[model samples]
Target: MPTPDLMTAELTLTGRITTASNATFLGSIGEVEVVYKPIAGESPLWDFPHGTLARREVAAYMVSQVCGWDIVPRTWLRDGPFGEGMVQLWQEQDPVQTAVNLIATNQVPEKGWKQVLEGQDEDGQMVALVHEDSPALRRMAVFDMVVNNADRKGNHILAMTDGHRHGVDHGLTFHSDHKLRTVLWGWLGDPLTAEERDGIDRVTEGLNGGLGRNLADLLSVEEIESIATRCARLRLEGRFPAPSGEMPAVPWPLF
Candidate 1:
């Protein structure tokens, strides 16, 4: 169970995420929109330990910070009705604006799967995927691969109206084994830009300093090693593309 602190105030529920695998509540503490998840009393799918949920949530925020993108939600540990649990800041986005919907609308040219998340067209349909050729997107691909994220579905990406792309649903991250599955497969075999290489180097360097110590508390040694190995491989290959492996590129259900 999480130790209660004074700053951890009770949250008031305003909505519910019925489609999620876990019981998630959309609520607010003061003026902040947040989502709450109580500890499992009966069945737990991921079977997380008492404090692992909060730790993993924090880990996601740390990774996002290191990636130079405020793409992840702010997460913290808090006392819940059931037990210790995790809470995340809820982002206000268009209910219909998702990577999947944006891509499937076909408002953009179908060069490949890369036409996803570009933007809406003049006729209010989705345009081509803009991040397909960006250095930032390439770095994100490497980050996802290192984390072994198995559920990088289109819906997981939140495309803000202000041109910011945020990714959510990171509960399945940090798997000790390789299990990466994502939809950003358009960059396979493309050479990494200079900026992309520098970002990989930055990530590798970060792992040797404070960032490494912070992750050490939440992730296992093997997981940390996986992060290092992925960075090294990307640096050596000098390319941003789909990795050659027997694993599937997409996860089931798309979310």
Candidate 2:
């Protein structure tokens, strides 16, 4: 649950993150760092309803909790300097860690990494998109599948020193339609482990309980149901799904 201090604290904005598409602020509550995305600053999208991104973000966090993977950082909705928005505890990723990378096509290692795609760069040099084949990253891929994440770009994954991976920028998630755009398709046909199956079971169980009620406040009836649908579909398949929509499989600006 989001603490009242997060909503009532004097949020002091330290800077604007120019890289983000929507207005994003770096702020602090006493000593805790947080990222704020005001609802007013969100640009309209043809596919998504207006001013609902913040709610989707909070919903993603709630689902993350149900899975017990800690794939997403703590997130909540709150009133901020710019108005009501989504606030998430900022994770300080390990600067030396590289969970995802683009490297020369020939340089891809045979083990410990999964190559996603190979393409030519601006200068026509061949490069391959790859990510570490670690348990932490694979768990994040399953989480993305459950959430219907539409923008799981390389930069959205934060690598930590303790080998944990955190996913961010979940505003483009939970849509009823099949709108999964991501770079984590390395496990397209891999079988789900027993642990992974248990995680999905936990999510299905959560949908019928408190988690369902909490999501009702943030998402539409159809969107909430779609979450259950996606979970059931994934569990039935028992493997990472291949892209099946007309839209591109991966987000642009892969890194």
* Global lDDT scores for all candidate models: 0.66, 0.93
Write model 2 residue lDDT over 147-248, tens digit each, in one string: 999999999999998989999999999999999998988989999988888888899999999999999999999998998999899889999989897999
Which portions of model 1 show Cα errors greater than 4 Å? 1-7, 39-54, 95-98, 101-139, 243-246
- State the local distance difference test value for candidate 2: 0.93
Check candidate 1 and list the clashing pairs.
115-129, 118-128, 118-129, 118-130, 119-127, 188-241, 188-242
Name the TM-score of candidate 2: 0.97
Ten residues in a row with the worst lDDT in model 2? 1-10
For each candidate, C-alpha RMSD in Å?
6.0, 2.0
Candidate 2 residues lying further than 4 Å off, grouped into runs, are: 1-4
TM-score of 1: 0.78
